[model samples]
Target: MKELKAFLKSKDVSKSEIFKALKISYDEGLILQYLCQLFFGSIPNISILNLLQGLFKDKEEFSYLDHLKDIRHLMELGLVKTGYSMLQDQNKESLFSLLHMDISLSEYFLQFLENKKPLDLSINVAYENHLEYLKDEFERIKLYTRLSFNPQNLDFKKDIQAYEAHIKKRLAKSKFYNVLAEIFKENKLSKKEQIIFIALLKEEYSLKNEESSSRELNSLLALVSENELEKLKNRALLDENSKLIEKNLIDYDEFSNHFYLSESILQRIVNFKRLDKDKQLRLENALKDQEIFELIEPNTDINDVIMPAKTKELLENILKQQDKKVLERLSLWGIKNSKEVEAKIIFYGPAGTGKTMSALSMAKSMKKVVLSFDCSKILSKWVGESEQNVRKIFDTYKEIAQNCKQSPILLLNEADQFLSTRVESGASADKMHNQMQNIFLEQIEKFSGVIIATTNFLESLDSAFSRRFEYKIEFKKPNFKERFLIWQKALPKNAEFSEDFKLDDLAQYELSGAQIFMVVKNTALKVAVSKDGIFSMQDFRESIEKELSSSFDKSKIVGF
Candidate 1:
């Protein structure tokens, strides 16, 4: 207060002007104090009634004239200057003219207050629901700004009236109004694009918990032109080549005509921006109707497995090789000109042959979390929705990778579901399946994260998908020697084997390692339940017979 007064007095202003300036400084101090409260605390909103009550508290004895003078000064010197700065601060006044003050001013205040300069206290939005707080502030702004809407000048008056009416009629009722307000301030959406975007929101609001909320281009034909739709498509690419309309708020699949908000922006909208990775994921999962991917908690140390010597050597080489140096050396040696820093590994083979186990081992050795998923879970019955789910799964992993210190491995089990050969059939369902493959093709080309995909039917997979896997190691059924080792590891030492039961004979069944372990466990369980807990060769034989017979029976049922 003294500094402002001294500076004003140094200018040698008139007596009345000095009085006004001094009064203005006093009023500005009060306003600054209120703003400081907003900026320095987790409380995102302050209501008009509460603010006014605090301002005029214990002042009933004061005349109305004095109260009016304070109000006038606060408006003239505080909010007026704040609003002007928000609108003109970027030197893009024309862009601001396209914006409504209700959103622009509030967003500016939020972004400005995020700065740590000269604030009196530390503010944390951790415990409270930030979205709700933003909504309350938005409501306050709407109410306050409406009081000054002018009806005199036709040009300015018509624009303000129409803007207010549009917001009220379209966005006011939305629970996402505050988030949309911030998004609008950040992005440059044309009127039509904004309308279509809002319509997408409205569509999402109408869906049931399990229903797909993806939108198609045809659905927006009535709202926007083809040119605008195409622009939206190009901007959604996961490359630097694409031009973003709103700092990448939404992701669009050009092939399937599907589009949705990006997960990061969605988290920001919900005020989950500052949360730790695990908490953010948990909150996101709780909000979702379905889980996008399965998260695996693997052992901290890599597990040893008995596999083919060639396969073992290949995998060991990959584990031992430094991925960063390999990429750097390739660029330095002029072998390739690329910026990709990821290792795309693939392990495809029969079940129980160590594909999944190898993937877990590789991730553990790298000290990275394994984000595994069964592709069947992501496939939806609705048209175009399955492709959208693929994008979501990839995008979700990308977000997780960004927050993690070590890049995580995205292990896709049963990759055949989306990686299979595309049929050239004329049916739309077939085409949709092909579209899912196409989406992955594009996404995988630009993928910048480590991925490990496994499949049972490697021969059935599309050549294009197979070609993208940098480390394509085929997992085979363990032979007699490997099976012998696996059996030795799986069997309990306390279990007694019959004198006639030979461990060498057990490896000759051509069963996978998983089947061998299951046979031994089942034999022990049956013997323990019926007899003296497995001292006979008959127990092991019966269990093996049943297991082998089930596969034969299934084959018989299928007329194989």
Candidate 2:
């Protein structure tokens, strides 16, 4: 009673506020005094209705107090016994019977007490259902007080410790612990639950003897495999200050030079601590091999391409030999061993030839995804940054490959300018060029993935750089037969052409397959756009002239 009086008299609270909070009737101040006395140790003789009326007079203003009133009413109705006698008796069945009756009365009283606080009936039901198992009198008191006032201030650590204590107390008196042990032996827990349970067991038990401790530890460790144990240990070691370099030393500067992404983006990705469990799982799945090949675009097969028959046969044999060698090397190391094969192909040819198409065709034939690297996009004007960006791109590709469980085809388009062997004459531009080229060569040689590089001016490329590729395919201008087929493929299926539409005669103009296709497309567009649905020879001639004129003008501007 003195403690309650002191609490009520605190500067932060007032008697009027307590009266409003408890929703007590003006006449029932004496009843409140009696309750305070009983709480602090005093006996009282008052009708349960008088106590309920005092606590629930203005249920709308102080509905939380109504639950305490219901408890008292249930006691009066003989649905429950006052004090902790029922809990201490261990008569769970009898306790449950009384609880059921109390619950029904509580519900009726709650309905009668209209405009009350929004109480969670489910929580109340759960508490009632588990009341028999709640053995910690201190915890029960703390929980009740918190729920009655500020539930938000409830301490999880205190609750968990109290729950553990309750379990321990029950295990000391019953066969519950032995039953739990049998259940654990018969069933496997999920990885997350296993970790938590193992941690809990470790905290609860401390073996006095070394052998017994070892046995217990071994039993806990048996829940996970050796590899999983190592993984758990590794993960445990990765705290906030953990660095990537600690596990595996990477040449960050060299890596940066090869990938064109910004250091900030790379750092953000590398240092990203997965906060969400689902997101972490997603990241883990992405790291698997299934998603790797999807990052690359589909490439065309070079073998099916039409060219000079001799050249085609010679190149096909070379590619076949290279493929065999790659397989042999891979087999020597072991199948599914990605470390042995150095997958690089070089395609050299004049401008307007099929070098790029050949690389695409090769990828298509192999049924592999191809990713074209735009050197211009990776190369930066800022000093040192270009190499870093290039490295990042390669690293990204490598990560994609690791996740997808497949090697991606890296199509380094326009390989001549950067890969050229020309030495710098101590000029800044040449120095930059040399640095970038060296980084590219180093990365390509070390890369386990497939690479296809195309060069228009083979002579201009450094011989040293040219030697690195396993196969060199030359793309020549399409011959007459090939040219005729190109025209057939390019033209729309429904278009009607006269006998004078001779592709062999058109081949005499020395037009590339792309140029021929462009001409056909332009001529078709003109015919379609015209008011009359007619294909005219004049339209074809005009399209050809227009293309030729543009090419001639561009060549003159370059002083070719």
Q: Clashes in each model (backbone N, CA, C under 3 Å)?
A: 0, 27
Please list the C-alpha lDDT of all candidates, in the order they appear: 0.56, 0.49
lDDT of 2 by residue, 393-511 (tens): 68767655553323667888886776677685988767777787778778877877568788877778777677788777787766667877777777788976654665555555556
| TM-score of each candidate structure, all chains considered together | 0.46, 0.44
- RMSD, candidate 1, Å: 21.6
Candidate with top TM-score is 1
Q: What lDDT score goes with residue 53 in model 1?
A: 51
Off by over 4 Å in 2: 1-296, 318-342, 403-405, 552-560
lDDT tens readout by residue for model 1, 1-560: 44334333332322333223223455444533454445445544453334445655766743222443343333322232222231122333433232222111132123222322231113322214434444333332322222222213244335444544644544434543355655665465655455455545543444523122124333332223323344345333322232232345555654444556556655555443444668667646633544756666567334477778888788766664444345557779986555333578778877777788788877776667778788887667899998898788777777666655456788888787678888999998998888988888898898765788888887887889878888888887777789889888877788766778777767666777777788888877787786556556667667777887876323111110
Indicate which candidate wins on lDDT.
1
Give candidate 2's root-mean-square deviation (CA, Å).
Answer: 24.2
Candidate 1 residue spans exceeding 4 A from truth:
1-289, 300-303, 323-331, 334-341, 552-560
> Which 10 consecutive residues of model 2 have the lowest summed lDDT?
102-111
